[model samples]
Target chain A: MKKKLTQFTAYFIIWLLLTWSLHFQEVMVGIVVALIATALTRDLFPDEMIKFLNPVRLLWAIFYILYLIFYIILANFDVAYRVLNPSLPIAPGIVKVKTGLKSELAKTFLANSITLTPGTLTVEVVEDNYYIHWIYISTEDPKRQKQIIIDRFEWILRRIFE
Target chain B: MSNPVAIFLITVGVIFDLLGCLGLIRLPDVYNRLQAATKSVTLGTCMILFGTFLEFGFTSGGIKALICLIFVLLTSPTAAHALARGSHISGFKLWEGSKMDKLEEDKGK
Candidate 1:
């Protein structure tokens, strides 16, 4: 029941954000739409939906977004420099890095973060191991690779999702 | 719109879009091309939408532009990840200059 309410609130908030209107008719329609949508997707959400309400986690999530955008811009310039360089200097490779996070949601966030930041793309995830494609193979050691890729985002993600 | 910031952002976005296309053409292999193109084009498109938001303010069109930006940010990397995994699973080869293939190594064991 609480999960249903949480989902309803989420959908209603999205509806409000999308419409940005306060008319009685609009609000009524928005509520109905959110209800139907929530009912339809009731069982799809993880059981820990209520954890999203924690203020500290919410703060960390906002921080994560700002952190992600900063890295993304930095990453773009780094890639742009390589792409424009005369030699096309890339030492591309697929490397495996392990994550200690147990939650699927956190893993997804980590993978998405990896894809946008620096010169890395997460090609696959097998259990706790992520197979990432690196644009530059800076080090061959697995621990250093994990430090560079997963560690940057994993700790914050644990706070938010785990 | 007469907003110079908006115009400037749109101009930078176009340059990034152009670079992304160039990377698609110039890069040696599928994974390399995916990396370069996805990063550049996704950011380029987001910048363009954000510029539109700045130009239009809080109107419906502007709000929609923000929504589109969020959707692009959420989905583009996911789509690219899917493509990279699909191609690798189906046996696409990395460029010869690539330094390692740990995914392949895992497959061997």
Candidate 2:
């Protein structure tokens, strides 16, 4: 019964968010038709983790979205500074770092985060470690670079999901 | 709380961020730069966000900043680690300064 309620709420809230985005007459009619279709197909699956009942978590997700916007700005500035420099000033290299995450979701989130950040690209990650490619490498001590991301980003991830 | 305190936090955060950026520019290899950028930016961002919180009080922006601060701290390193390990597994060349390519040998086995 609870699952059914959650599923219904998910469909309703999803419809609400969709309509909020597209308030056109044709779109609204299409949205209503699509929502009815979704409602009919709802019980075919058991749990999608798509329940909309967790208002706190939803708020947290929205807050995270806002956070992404701010960080992306900072990231853009860093990338621009590198691009605008007199010399092509990039010391690209591949570095390996350790991961302390205990779950796959946490690890995947971390990987996506690295990719999302402009300068550094996530090359590969396996069994609690990462192969990261950075556009530059100013430090002789590899640990210095490793610690910045590890302590800075990965630690925060520990709090949010795991 | 005070203006100086807020400024101090923001400065420190920016310094870390700058250091990270500086490291990326000066570093030799991808692995090396990833080390610098992720660490510096994440920590620096948090510090800056904390300062923003102090300035803005417990409003939506402040709360949002705090949430972002937390997110950066969490995802940045894990991403770095994944990339590094992936590169190692995928046979991307490591730096000349690297003391060990043990992962390479392990992969071979």
Backbone collision count in every prediction? Answer: 0, 43
Return the TM-score for each candidate structure: 0.96, 0.49
Q: Candidate 2: which docking quality band?
A: incorrect
Off by over 4 Å in 2: A1-12, A19-63, A140-142, B1-109
| DockQ measured for candidate 2 | 0.08
Off by over 4 Å in 1: none
Writing each residue's lDDT as its tens digit, candidate 1 over A102-154 gives 98888888999999998999999999999999999999999999999889898
Please name the candidate that would achieve the greatest lDDT relative to the true structure: 1
Write the residue-wise lDDT of candidate 1 on B1-109 in tens digits: 8899999999999888898898898889999999988899888999999999999999888998999999999999999999999999999999999999999998988
Range of the 10 consecutive residues with the lowest summed lDDT in candidate 2 chain A: A45-54
Q: After best superposition, candidate 1 residue A58: deviation in angstroms?
A: 0.6
Per-prediction CA RMSD (Å): 1.4, 9.9
